[model samples]
Each structure stands twice: as C-alpha cells, then as structure tokens.
Target: MITLDHNTAQRIVDRAMQVIGHSVNVMTPDGVIIASGDPLRVGELHHGARHVALRGESLAVDASNAEQFTGVRHGVNVPITVGQHIVAVVGISGEPAKVLQFADLVKVTAELMLEQTALLELGQHRRRQTEDTLLALINGRAVPQSWLDRIGFDLAQPRLALIIEPAQLPGPDDFVILLMRQLELSDKSLLLAQVAPQRLLVLAPIKPASTTALRSMTEQALSLLQSSLSANVHMAVVIAAGQYIEGSLQGCYESALATMASGRRESPHSSVHCYSDDPVTILWESLRPSWQQQELLRPLQTLRAHPRHLLYVRTLQAFFDANGDVKQCAAVLHLHRNTVRYRLKGVEQLTGLSPFRLPELLHLYLALKSDDLSTKQ
Candidate 1:
C-alpha cells in the first residue's frame, strides 16, 4: 500500500516549506526540481548544492561568501534517503537558523511523497522512452502505428533527406521544426531533425501523386527562404532524386554531405550561387598569364601620350563623371577656372573624343570600365 500510495508532492513541499522562510525547493536525485515555495523557482533546475547530491548531507552558506550570489537567504540541502538510497533532496531557503530546525522533519515528509512520485515518474518516462526508441527503429511507423504514435514519421510514403544550408542560419532548430509543421497536412509529411549543428535532415515524403507538384512547391519555398534567410547560408541543394529506399538513405546522406562540401565559400564580390548540372564548373579551369592580360588593352596605347596630354584626358573624364559640369570638376580637381576649360579643349584636340557626341562618349565609357575591371583582376 505504501509503495502504491499517492500524494500531492508540490502541496507537501508547499506546506513544509511554508514553515521555513524566503524560498524553498525539493528536487529529485537527478536534479529535476519537484516542487518549491517560490512560484518562479518551482519545477526549475536545482543546481545550488553539490554536497547534498554526493554525500547525502546538509550544506549552509551565506551570501557574503559569493561575490555574485543574490541575497541573504540561508540554505539547507537535506538529502531524502529511502532505504540507504537518496531518492530526492529538500533544499530550504529562509532565515538561516529556522531552516536548519525543520531540516530533519522536512526530509522524512518530502522524501515519502518524492519516493512514490519518483517511481511513478520513472515508470512513465521509461515507457515513453521505450516507445520513442521503438518508433525510431521502425521505418514504416512514420504513417501511424497505434502503439508507436510518439514520432510523426510518415511510413507509407518513402522519404528523401534534404540538407538546408541557408544563407545566414546560425542555427535554425526551431525554424526548421516550424517548416516541418507547415508541411504536415499533405499526403507526404516532412520531419526536420538536426543531423549536425548546421546540417538539418529534412525527411520529405515521396508520395506518387506529390512528386512534381511538391518539387515545385519546395523550390518556391526555398526561393522565398533565400530572400528571407539566405544571408546566413551558402550551401547548394543536393537531393537524392530517385526512389526513397532505406538502403539508399546512407547514399542519399552521403550525397547531401558531398554536395555541401562542394559548396563554394562566400566571396566578397558575389552574394550567392546555386548549383545545378552546370558545366561551368570546368569552364574556367585555367588562369590567364599576366603577360596575356597585358595584351588586352592594346588600343589604349593611342590615348597614352605626353604626361600633360594624359593629364588633360583624366580631367576630361572627371568632368564627364560630374555630369559635364566643368566648374564642379575644376573645383574638385583644384585647377584654375580657365584651366579646366583649357584641359577639355586640349583633350578634344589630342584624342578627338568629343564630350557632346553620344557615340564617342560610349567608347570612352567602355574604355574606362574595361580598364577598371582588368586592373582589379
């Protein structure tokens, strides 16, 4: 009867703790808090004392001993022993001396309720944990197995794994779970689990009716995500495209990892890149020799002349960039008021590049752009 007896452990802790002071707490042997007087601390993690755990004894401390410890609450962590085994612990906080007085009585009362509660909890947890293990092992239980409904794995439809490396995802644990829930209603369900810290394993069902349609939807969803979350991610999508078989999961997983490994590092110049069956991988294999690059601007030789002539040419280009405002270019380049006019006149005479002519202006623009790009490369 005693082994099967039921009790309100929280109220017992509440009543017993009321005799003491400030805030009191009771914790299981494993540190999961069972009950407390403080509303905020109830059902929270108990990490106050290590001695009560190891030696099953009481420990007292003053706040002056700790630099960052909060207040002047006296602490007593009394171990609740059941037949030489410590089942739980009652930790009291209040006026230092009074908590020590009720320590022995609280231990006996709290441990009684805690022992029974702990057993019931252990049994329930064991049952649920066993169910979880069974669900994990069973492949087809993704659909619905009455005994193994703990996990939402869609068994009827084979699943393909997708690794999402978003543009800027530091860790998308909750977001990935939300995405899976969003896909829960269809014939094929999605389950997102973290395979690695950055690699999220998405189990997408491959129902016959959902193939093409789902693929389209997935691409659209990813595109939207790209606009939203692409800042943290830089990996390409590598799908194991064929039939989803259990034997193929390893291959599929390997395929996804290989694809991620092959993903390029972020370049300061490019925002993002998507990989497909692109042959451009081998297109730019060889680097051009510097001597060959130097041969690219051969026609610019006509423009490179006397130092003073080059000066007039640079001044004329600056004037164009200032929207043909010679006075603005004059002030910026710090030339005499007439000196800017003289440079433009000299530029028109020497290179024959007219500022007013659209065609000549186009040529000058191309020359400048080509030189800038080539110079940077």
Candidate 2:
C-alpha cells in the first residue's frame, strides 16, 4: 500500500472538492486524515475511511450512523486502489445519498493521477542512475562488471569520442534525442550523455571500412552536425587513431580535449576539427609560449616595425612555396624576377640569414609557422 503524504493527499482532496462542489477529505490506509476541506479535521482519524480501506469497498455514512464512527460525517468514502491493493481513501462530505454519485468518479481520478506521478518518478530515477554510470565510465572510474553487462555496452571495439559544447545548455534527454536524429545513429551504435551543463560527450564505434570510406563517412556526419547545431553553437570533433581499445578511452578523451582547445585557438570559425587531420597544429599548440618565441622568430620581429611588414612576410612565404626558384617565386607573387630578387636581398639584410642557405631557409620556415600559430592564439 502506498501511503498518502500531506502534500499529495491535500492536492487530491482539493481537486476532488473542485469537481464535486463539496468538502472532501483524503485519508491514508491507516485512516488518518492527511487532507480535508475543513482545516480543523486534518490529522483526525476517520473510522469510516478505515473501514472502507480494510473492507476494500465503499462505505456510506448517514446521519443515523455518523455518530458511531470517530470524526465521521454524513458522507460517502471510497477506497483508492492501485492494481489490487487499497492505498488511500477519498471521501465527499455531504449527505450520503447526494454525494454517493460523485464518490466513485473522484476516487478514480485521484488514483489515476497518483499512478501517473509514480511512473514519472520511476522514469526520472532510472535516468539519473544511467547518467551516473556513464559519468563514472568517462571519468576513468572502474565500473562494476554487472553494470556493464546490464547496460550492454562493449568497449572492445575502436571508438571515437566527440565532445560537444553548446552555447546554451540543453536538457540531457533533448540533446541526446536531437543528436541521434541529426547523426542518424541508433541506440545500439551510439552512446550519448551530458557530462556537464554545457558539455555533451558522445562515443560511437568506428565501423570497419576502408580508410577513405571511413574518412568520407566521418566528414558527412560532422557536416550534418554543423548544419543542424550551428544556429548558435560551436562544435569541435576529435578522432583518435584506429585500433583503440577500452583501456585507451581515457587517452582518447584527453586527445579530444586537446583537439577542442587547439581548434578554438586555430580554427575558431570552422565548426568541426579532427585531431588526426592536423597533428602539426595540435603539437605546436602544446608547446610552451616561451619555447614558441625562439631566436628563429627574431628576424620576423624586426620586420614588424616596418610599414611593409605584411609585404615582406608574403614575399618570404612565396619564396618558400616556390622552393627557392626565383622565376617561380616571381610568378606566384605576380612580381618581376628583379623585384623578387630585391625583396630576398632585403630579407637577407634585415635577418643576416641568406634565403639561399638551406639551414637559414629551414629556420625561417619554422619561424614563420611558429608565428602563424602565435597569431592564431
């Protein structure tokens, strides 16, 4: 039997009173008046309700018999049953003959509401449990084997973890549902959970296919997510190398975080970035700021004060792109060969490093790449 607390019983009593246009009382199985239209009657014991709950049937009290029962009034009391057990008693306080017609209706409505509330509470409890389990799994906590078996999650296969940070936090259930719909993923294939208010972590196994085919599929999935979630959201994707196993999931998570941080610094405009596609940028981003500002970048610093700083930088980039071919550099820059030679001479004078020397060229190239990363930061 489900005991009726004061708050829930009061709601049932109030709602019954509204429908019947009469005073009502809600009692627990033990006959204590948890709720009643008459405030003074609350907490009082009613023998008529106790009899109705014990007998599992409706009990009608008339003026003649009302005095025989404790706190009894001329009314009709019906048992509120869920399944086969009587859990509560709902009564209409009025003449027995007059209120008897509405007694069954009020009892049925109250029971139905209670049943619905119970189901909703059960669902919420299960969702919270599932969320806790997933949080443990992602946080590197050792989950019990029984839990994994119950949930039917196998981590032996290669998996990719995508961490999504939304501009506005979404409800956990809504975010999973929308993501699945957008990605065309089934429950068996994708695992989605909200790890934080604004962050959602999704893990899915990489299907066995050719490298090219897998790459294409991943790109299409990312494109769909960007188009669907980009209304006010920025999304970043990080894919780990193949042959990933269960023990490596934490490493994959770390890689995803690094990728997200790097993407925010380098490719903020692009909604999607994969770790495997740009390892150089990711590695470069990991270097300390002090190490990034090496002596190789000193030559470029001198040009920063010049009015034609951008022009000189472009010329040097073009020279590297042309592989030291003066004709090719001129063609790429839309400049005469003489102009290209003159710019290279100016670069040598400013840096004391000739572009024709292999070591100098290599140093200049690395310095330019380092500078690009810094600028993006």
lDDT tens digits, residues 256-351, model 2?
666677766666665566766665555555454584567758888776777887888899999987988999999998999999999888887877
lDDT of 1 by residue, 202-281 (tens): 55554443543544533443444334333222342222121233535544444444334334331322332222221122
- Model 1 scores worst on lDDT over the 10 consecutive residues at 277-286
Error of 2 at 42 (Å): 4.5
After superposition on all CA atoms, how large is the RMSD of candidate 2? 6.3
**TM-score for each predicted model, relative to the true structure:** 0.30, 0.64
Clashes within 3 Å, all models in order: 12, 0
lDDT of 1: 0.52
Q: In angstroms, how far off is 165's CA in candidate 2?
A: 3.3
lDDT of each: 0.52, 0.71
Considering every candidate listed, which one attains the maximal TM-score?
Answer: 2
